[model samples]
Target: MKSGLTVRSDNYADVLDALNKLSGTDVLVGIPAGPPREDSPLSNAEIGYLQSTGATVEIDGEIVTLPPRPFLDMGIEDSRDKTTARLKLAAQAALEGNSGMAEQHLEAAGQIARD
Candidate 1:
């Protein structure tokens, strides 16, 4: 299937969670150009996760060099939590016989699950 995907990095946690679900795909992650802000700089673990995925990373249009190996022990518990919630919503939609909504919720849950 052919499709387009776009995700904003406004919520770093969500972005990280979504990244967990990707497999064998090239991704471009862009960071705004300017003085790094304390609140916006990516954490070591996040960077490690992206490095593990081999995604192309750019900061202010400049390509970033990634380390050869990902740092150890990056957990995705937040993704599991979000996936559980979405699964529940999907179940509720199914009970209401709203197949389309159920499908949407399940799709979201799948993304969170990285399935």
Candidate 2:
């Protein structure tokens, strides 16, 4: 179990990295947390870096659900919200047989799990 504040700073990126390195496999990305904010905007380099490691990015954070399934680059309101959405999306993608995408989203979620 994770506390609300703890979840806020959940090292999602490290988690993804570990998961990738351990499994040596790719996964789909999802943003169950939502989308990235201005301060923490998703960058091509970041996305590319994750992709290079065999992962797909998705912005399924809980904040903005309008886009349904968005990419990490898409701008959103709060980092926490976006992070949550991405995490959820990543979980969904992984459960749906998209490990690459799941990993990507999980990475982003971990990134957002910061202070």
Measured on C-alpha atoms, candidate 2 has an lDDT of 0.55
Question: What TM-score number comes out for model 1?
Answer: 0.34
On the 0 to 100 scale, the lDDT of residue 91 in model 1 is: 62
Superposition error at 110 for model 1 (Å): 1.4
Provide TM-scores for the models.
0.34, 0.31
lDDT per residue (tens digit) for residues 2-73 in model 2? 666634465566556645543664333433344554665765555444544444344655442232233343
90 Cα displacement, candidate 2 (Å): 0.7
Relative to the unseen true structure, what is the C-alpha lDDT of residue 59 in candidate 2, on a scale of 0 to 100?
A: 60
